[model samples]
Target: MDQVTKIANRLADVGGVVAVCLGGSRARGTHTPDSDFDLGLYYRPPLDTSALRVLAAELTGGAVEVTEPGGWGAWVDGGGWLTVDGARIDWIYRDLDRVYRIWQQCKAGLFEVGTQAGHPLGVYSHSYAGEVAMGRILADPTNELAALQEQIQASYPQPLRDSLVAHARWEVPFTLSLARKGVTRGDAFYIAGCLFRVAGLLAHALHAQAGCWVLNEKGAVQAAGQLPTAPANFSARAHALFGALGATPDELATAINDADQLAADVLDNLSPG
Candidate 1:
């Protein structure tokens, strides 16, 4: 068996582990030769972290620490990092019940972005559903994960799409207004932060309009640029705006104006999905 398959089997054998799946760029078939494996481990409550830690150590031939549930955060849950056979593997834990609940929320057009360390733009609650929709099952003895994945892949919820687009559309201008204030004071740092938020929000709106699930902020703008609903030169303009940001009041003001124009273009181009 391949290394990933072997790893997934081992993970599935761990007590409380309901399913194991491949995630990230690898699962999406967009991975480069160097992309590390992102493995999702869906488990019930009272997970056997001790077993997981032992298994990780065995796989790596060294001591490894597995975080307890909620160790990473509420949304991210917990897991461990390991290098098996010289290949990096990330174990991301998901509470099965929580995943179901979150998926239901997405179907109902209700989602929230929560603070998470690794996710600079915050973790979207629908990301759990996205993960399942995008993941490739490696081991699912009970067929629960497969069934859930099928349900998620069947269709992109219209309510979820509308909710995401509406929220992002509202935030883009609100965030830009904050950046405008910073431009007058030549607060490049603050202005830059707000601009990044604007870009991210615009990406979110575009992805929603395209009925795509945005897993995170990484490459989100570029991904949105690929969508038919995206504004012309959306990613290029966003990149240029960021590249042109300057510390001077006049330069910052110009960047703000460009960003506002980009936002208007995106809003104008958006159509009902």
Candidate 2:
């Protein structure tokens, strides 16, 4: 159908490729005109790393920038837009069996119900489950928001669902601000990671409210009180981290506003103090 899919199929036809999976906003159907296709190339065991690298380099028409491995397998950025008969294409490659399972699962399920059966999905990722969990916590049968939360609540829970209300309301805004700053400063990886992290937080915040969980100002405040203190020396590093993310004051305000609304809505559904 699409050029990316065609290329993937072609690549799969190559001898060593075990499977070719798609990912990113494009795969999720949230792509804009400029979004590039993100593909994960999983090869059978005993892959010739050099050979694969050579093929990718040749295919991409630009140098490959490899992300440091996070234990399983390395992630490589395939630069250059591949033009097949005048159509532009850009993509990334992850070593087979080395990708994050949650990403794979979500990508697989994008087109159909049973698409993600054997792969890992964001089911266990706190970022993915955060908002949904929060919505569940604030269940109110009469409210429209409550109904929406109820719709997705059965699917999954945040990694730390009970603790999300407090953390998400504060941390998400902070992290979002930090992430934008990182993006501005060219800390793309940090920005991407923080964005995903905040998404999970928002998900939890929404779920807690919809589920009518123990989510109230008192509970939230208590959760805030329980936050682990950062060491004094780390304060500077923390600020630098924020700086790296290019966290802006305005962006922080927006995050805070969104988090607050989600929090207030959940609070409204509460059955009094």
Candidate 3:
């Protein structure tokens, strides 16, 4: 464990590397025995991943999963994955300029949600801000990470929260409306999709209210189920919403209404600390 931290500290010496930190479950101290080590490298524009790739190769002494800087497309364009001494380590690249801009926009009452490949549920721009602010700094020789944490950590701006809340409030009903329409058309697939989308939106809203930054939609349900405001037996409810074998139209409508009301109540009473 110390060696991994030591290696991460060394990565900060690379050019354009502003900070290197530990993130994800490990940083949050929520890691299980099998959880992967998430090493985040904060860099400004003109990032060079060669140093990372070379280091990974040196550590593994074999082929490693790495991409040339900017090769992986948006959201994550650099970094690599390595297994050092049987410990799984994932390197994630963060553009400090982009994260800073997103955090600034969040403070200015601006936020946007969109979906990307491999992230079917969705993503929010403000998520990056939270990660940067909440991450555990491992190497910050120039004090860049310290400065960023000062501006971003645990800072829940009202605009960002309100934006997400409003978005969820609208989306829940919008999808429910479509689901109702699907019943009329006997389109089970449409209803299923609507349910999935509404679940994700509700989960997103809950995370926002909890002052949690969500990077993807994959774990939204389980995470939301743990929130204080979330309904009891959320996993069961999710199953009922998504798992209905030849369910009648009326049953589907009931589920939709239940979700709608649950989402509304949660949004209305939200108070992020």
What local distance difference test score does each model get? Answer: 0.89, 0.41, 0.76
Query: How many clashes would you count in candidate 2?
Result: 46
lDDT of 2 at 33: 73
* TM agreement with the true structure for every prediction: 0.97, 0.39, 0.89
Q: Which stretches of candidate 1 lie over 4 Å from their true place?
A: none
Candidate order (lDDT): 1, 3, 2
Tens digit of per-residue lDDT, candidate 2, span 1-273: 265666666556555455555544454465677665555544444434455445556666655443222222222323234544444454333343332343234233321111122222122332222232332121122243334335434543333343445555577667756655653355556664665455444433544433322222212323322233212222232223334433555554444344344434443443221
Highest TM-score scorer: 1
Q: Give per-residue CA lDDT, model 1, range 63-178, as digits (tens).
A: 98799998998888889999888788999999998999998998999999999998988898988999999998999999999999999999988898888778877888899888
Better of 1 and 2 by lDDT: 1
Q: Tell me, by lDDT, which candidate is best.
A: 1
Candidates 1 and 2 compared: the better one by TM-score is 1
TM-score of 1: 0.97
Clashes of each: 0, 46, 0
**Superposed Cα deviation of residue 110, candidate 3 (Å):** 1.2
